[model samples]
Target: MNTQMTYTAFLDEQCLASGPLVDVATAIQQHANQSNATVLIFNDQTGKQIDLDISGSKQDIQQRYAEHPETVKKVGRPKLGVISREITLQQRHWDWLDQQSSSASAVIRKLIDKELNDPNSESNKMLAKQATDRFMSAMLGNMPNYEEATRALYQGNKEVFLDLIRDYPKDIYQHILKLSAYAF
Candidate 1:
């Protein structure tokens, strides 16, 4: 039986491997079964299964797997890369926040269900993109310290945001307080 396989279908580079031959064979077999292409596999004493090396972002790969369920299940597991965006707003921003996040399209919808349901909701902050944008814009044209600090946060630099949070803790505390009243 000849198990000679070429995974050029996934990548341009010539791949040399001596393991997980089964997984590749299985994946090919599944694709062949579903398509007009001819796929042949000979299961022998040498057992091997390795993931087919495909190059793409996690989100792109997940989308590919979603489109080809049978093929993915036959050979490999799709990796999930989720990003959680967190925002912190004050408890005093309820009226407007509630009205905004309640709408189905609002990205902050999940935060509202979790925080704004109870009358005595103590959530001082929220987690969302809108909140982050609002927070950044509010810091514009303020005192030099606040202006500089807020500028770094909105500039989309992770290191700057982290540093600002650490160096100017008082500013953050105050800014969040002011924005609390208008987080709609």
Candidate 2:
């Protein structure tokens, strides 16, 4: 996991902490010591729940969760923030790549960067919707009008979605809006 990534923790419907992993862990530990409520942690960017070992002292927990440098270097230039990964392409695609002046990796990177940088791209919208949906499913599945809100989300009806979830817990409602800002 990236140490720079932010995390959010909730004790049921109430958000307990939202920040870097170490700080969230410390807050969760404190909350756990005081109450028996189950604290669920999530990766803010992906809206995915994650489990962390928070059994020891704050320093110990931080050390345990800290992002460690890879012991073995891989194929790409790690210093330049590049890590090589395998990709499967059809023979015709490989043939076209082989004829290009630039390396296959460079061309692939350009295409990927273009798609990622486009704010109105379908892929970006789909990702935002998925992230929002995942978080809603986990946190507000039982809330009133959840199904309607989900339908409105996929249909790109921001007004109806917001209206449906307006009466929900403030933290969850705000987080949904934040996650789904680009979903439409």
**What TM-score would each prediction reach against the true structure?**
0.20, 0.85
Tell me the whole-model lDDT of each prediction, alpha carbons only: 0.38, 0.85
Best by TM-score: 2
* Candidate 2 residue pairs in clash (backbone atoms < 3 Å): none
Worst 10 residues of 2 by lDDT: 1-10
lDDT of 2 by residue, 1-184 (tens): 1225788998888889998888899899888889988888988768889998889898898887766776677777876678778999999999999998999999998888888777578988888788888899999888789999999999999889889999999888878887787788
What is the C-alpha lDDT profile of model 1 across 1-184, one tens digit per residue? 1223322122111122212443444454445445654332211121111243233544444454333324333322234322245567677665566667354225465665556544234332222223444444433334335555455544444455445554434544443433332222
lDDT of 1 at 183: 25
Q: What shift in Å separates residue 53 of candidate 2 from its native position after superposition?
A: 0.8
Give lDDT: candidate 1, residue 149.
47
